[model samples]
Target: MTTLLEPVLSVRQVLTLERVLAGEPEVVAGAGQLDRPVRWVHVAEAADVGVMLSGGEMVLTTGVLLAGDDELQAEYIRSLHRAEAAAVVLGLGRAFPAPPDVMRRAAERCGLPMVVLHRPFPFAELTEEVQSRLVRRKFAAVSLSEAVRTALTGLITADAPLQRLLDEIAQHSGCPVVVTNLAHRVLATAGERPAVDDVLRDWERISRQAGRGEGDGWIRAELGGRGERWGGILLCGYRGDAATGRLLADRAAEALVLHRMLGGGSAHSWEEQSAQSLLTDLIGGVVPARQLLPRARAAGLPVNRRTFVPLVVRDGDPGRLDRILRLLGMPGLVAELTGRSTAVLLSLARDQDAEALAAHFAARLRTETAPGTVVAAADGRIAWDDVPAGLREAQHVAEAVADSAAVLDLPPVVRLRDVHLRGLIRLLRDDPQVQSFAERELHGLLREADEDLLSVLRTYLATGRNKSRTAQLHHVSRPALYRRLEAIRTRLGVDLDDFEQAASVHIALLAHDAQQR
Candidate 1:
């Protein structure tokens, strides 16, 4: 069975000399000075005993050599003070009948704690007792460090998630554990007392403050692998001593780095993963922009210093896009969204134009996918905080472009304006009025046994009401096409020849298709 020692085993505890020595010790001087830590215990009878002490020691002596010599005793006390000893214990008996007045006055003036033993005390026994306790505390600290390392390493080897590892660390350390990217975004947290949000609510301020201090209440260690730093782990309100906290942080960091390294993929791939997660979150709009800053930076995104160009490519091959990105030496995150669409957060130089960049990506993507691929770039370059809005805009454009049919003059870089009518319809697809209008207009055709008449109308509208082309495309006689048109007009209560009416019906159709998609 293993037993845990007191968590706090500071050098200061040895100041309780009576308990340590098992004899009543008289405080001859410096009563208020006993608060200093006794790092070790040393016994000396030599006159120049101060030379042997490095400091933080409670020196014990019988004073057998300097009996009744005021000058030598005062000098000895002064030397101990100069050496920064914790306290001085004068063993009574042969040394003197009682504590010397001159040495006591000097000690009092110097504020060096002086204790006089009232009875004969075995110096060796005191040394053994204090040293044993100190040694036990050292071993206990080593045990705790090993215990923490083993627990975290075990979890890492078992394929535990990052949050689970942090949870274990927090459980052992009894404090909140936070993992963040270089940009200072909170990635995961565990054992957050009072709530995780409370710890992260002011992360910016807290991080800045913690950065300026040295192990005050918070401790941190960098998480790195493959010579590239991923981020860091932070512990708030750590209860252990500074040394132990550092050890724990180091072990946790090592485990975290190793876990990432062994999880499959390289640093570049992990960088993409990080970016993909951040971009997905931005598109989702679930997490705040400020919260994503650190992750963006740590993921090799210039969140602080560079402009971001949000881009989306629909119905394109992701592998081709990834290869193109690698060839261009552009670092960005690419995530496969729902369907055939993919989202990208491209980091651009501050002076680069979003249009030029988008055009470059579009040209390469179109070459890869061939025939056609809709590439939508956000209106302009934006700050990291504004990237989410850009993502939304780019996604809107991509969806609109995908639903469009007669975009004959396609620009390399499509935007909201490029999508025109189709863009507006896609945006409003979910609006109550749009849905009601689509249902009301297309209700008859939607209820048909077959979509023959619907296809005819679609071909006719797509051909700008050109009877010849519509009939030829549908492989039907002009009269047959006319009949289908008549059926459409009757069902929708509109004339296909009227421009305004045809435009309305076309928009409704586009919205219906977009909704289906």
Candidate 2:
């Protein structure tokens, strides 16, 4: 059965020929064949009629030119096979009272469908009926294409989310719909009848092979407009005809591009805005956890039964982090918090420890980020309701460690508990009293003296007063380094050998740097 919205073709089978000719047509040879598309209905009386057909055409003839010579008839059938005709319908009576044996044997030998008209039938009637049906089907296909475009456009105007739009397309096409970035990360998915997880569980491999071949049962359409390509929309397990699958994928892509444009502002992509908004609101803490839970889940976080681990990374590529997350199949939200910082919220299984996960995450990012990059995470995992606090805590640690002597240790995961006194000083960096204390303690160093003394002081304090390392770092002799250190102590009115004075100087330096950042 063919619906008005389904693709149409003009291929005729032997069964269809019998039906069209009102049971007068009988399959005399190649009787068990009825499947394959027909191109057109053709009629010719010449001996070399096979040369006239392009392919897949049902040739209606009287066998007047193909009669008598068994060898000639066999050659004619072979020529039809070479030309790829659909079937041969021979009319009986005037040309031959009975079906010709030579043509019947030739048709069977060549495996060409041979149908004989046992009763008187006009060739014109058969041609007219088949041609009209083909025309109607072609027009129906056009109408269906337009209808899909209209439906998808209407959904776009409704401000439906990306997943909802994909769902509708899946319903129409009876397949799964997947939206992916150019890096092949599954951004959103819909229309998997069993479950979306089933489709996405192996998305990395599935997306790699998508649109390259038919064995994968996938089709793709480019998903961008305005002279820029964003990504692609994939149709998985599309059982419909190839033409209809293309139509469905293209319509879905158009709707997605339109949805992104309408939902996003001029400056940021819709995905980026969605990530930033959710993260910003989470840390802002005005909205209730229950209210925000739905949004988090909709954004693809497994928030219900999972632990929330908040992380902040500095000096790393946010794009590369995003791609790695997708490659590892980790469910998380990553967004740029500042030009030099990126914030992340990772969802881990209930049994997983946040410390271990943070270490792994930081280690992976360390290889890709610039040297001296700092990755700070919350001290421990928290429940979903406390995620905002967790995010703020990680952000505080990241701020505390950025450009500070603490990052010299390069711990895999810097935590609030790990930064010690420096973290506390950084946390209080904005206080008027703390700013005054730093300015007072380091006023002499801040004065126009050789800046090398300040560098030596910063490095010497960072390395726990290791004079040899400090000298080697500054490419100077031990006395030269000692001279710089003595100058720093004199400027700050502190003793390098006194632990209390050294600690005060360290805290002031940390506060000064945090405030600058």
lDDT of each: 0.75, 0.74
In model 2, which runs have C-alpha deviations exceeding 4 angstroms?
1-270, 380-382, 405-407, 447-452
Best by TM-score: 1
Per-residue error (Å), model 2, residue 248: 19
Worst 10 residues of 1 by lDDT: 1-10
Please write out the lDDT profile of model 1 over residues 1-517, one tens digit for every residue.
1123323223335546455546667788998876565667899877778898887788989989778788988899989988888888888896787888998999999999888888788888888878887677678778988898888888878887666787888888788887776766566667854544556555666677656655465888887766878778888768766656767778888877887777834344544454566678888889888776655554445555567788888887666777888788776767777787888778877777756777888887777675567888886556666888999999888887674333235788788887778788888889998999988778878865637887777767766788998888778899988888888888878988999989888877887878878
lDDT of 2 by residue, 1-517 (tens): 2443444343334346554557377778876554545657888777787778777788888877766777777777777888888788888877778888888888888778888888877788888877776677667667867877887788778866665677788778777777666666555566753545556655546666784654435889887777988778888878755556777777777777777788732222545555776788888898776566655664557766788888888776667877767776667898888657788889888788767777887777767765577888885555788888888898888887675534268578888887887788877999999999998888888855656677778788888888888888779999887777777877778897999888888888888878878
Roughly what TM-score does model 2 have, to 2 decimal places?
Answer: 0.50
The root-mean-square deviation over C-alpha atoms between each candidate and the true structure, in angstroms, is 8.0, 11.7
lDDT of 1: 0.75
Residue 384 of model 2, lDDT score? 83
